[model samples]
Target: MDDASSQSRPSADQPNPFSAVPIEITISVGKARPLIRDLLKLGKDAVLPLDKRVDDAVELYVGERLIARGELEELEGDQQGQLAVRLTEVADLQDGLG
Candidate 1:
């Protein structure tokens, strides 16, 4: 067999194998689990507190996997008053499912 035969071609259905792939990334500030009764009782002004403090680093998740930890920041210039995450710690790819 030749080297050309060993390599596979891209299928017509997917022009680029990595193209059009979707990933969901979420930056979690904190988490809270309230009782059903408490949840129902919450009104407009009610505050649901999170487990994390204001200074704590937020977790960055790809779907349900924890990919990195970052600090929240305010974007300026072109981003103008928008919020963004500044990655402080990144998870190692070699780490087993961590």
Candidate 2:
């Protein structure tokens, strides 16, 4: 067998489709409202309210782009639960953007 032929083809021992893509899993996204410097003077237990309302759907972002919006839900036995995003709207938006 020639050196060129052996070099051009992959070996049998090599793994199939040998590449992995990295993905991030976001747990929760709430509107962040930073307290003013003067407000910090109040010290601990001082309530700094978030900009978003409880009924409002929280926006999910991947990198810098908006991905979806979901309502927060509590799972049984698990205090830290999942967000149920509206799939149809998200898919449509993603398709349109793409």
Candidate 3:
């Protein structure tokens, strides 16, 4: 390899950059805010209501920034019953992770 090309490449000791790194994508189904008294009064099998319904689109976030919106779905096949999101509205990031 030429010296110029070798110099431009990342060394083995250096990190692989964000391309190979993993970032946690948080999926927010809904939010529920209960009073402190009501929060503490919860018991086993008790249900706390959320702002959204079962048919509502869930929000995806990377950190605090909202990334995309999608509907909740159950997987088929061996992964059946596993919950997933089908993105309906994705943000225009323009190369940004957020």
Q: Report the Cα RMSD per candidate.
A: 4.7, 6.9, 5.1
Highest-lDDT candidate: 3
TM-score on alpha carbons, each prediction: 0.74, 0.51, 0.77
Better of 1 and 3 by TM-score: 3
Q: Write the per-residue lDDT of candidate 2 for residues 1-98, one digit (tens) a residue.
A: 56897775667876535446666646345655575675666668866667777867766666666666667666545545754555323525545323
**Whole-model Cα lDDT of every candidate shown, in order:** 0.86, 0.59, 0.89
lDDT of 3 by residue, 27-77 (tens): 998999999999999999999999999899899999988889999999999
Error of 1 at 30 (Å): 0.8
Model 2 ranges with Cα > 4 A deviation: 1-22, 25-29, 32-35, 77-88, 91-98
Candidate order, lDDT descending? 3, 1, 2
Clashing residue pair totals per candidate (backbone < 3 A): 0, 0, 0
1 or 2, greater by lDDT? 1
Q: Candidate 3: where are CA atoms >4 Å away? A: 1-16, 94-98
Q: What is the lDDT of residue 90 in candidate 3?
A: 91
Candidate 1 wrongly placed segments (more than 4 Å)? 1-22, 96-98
The alpha-carbon lDDT assigned to residue 92 of candidate 1 equals 85
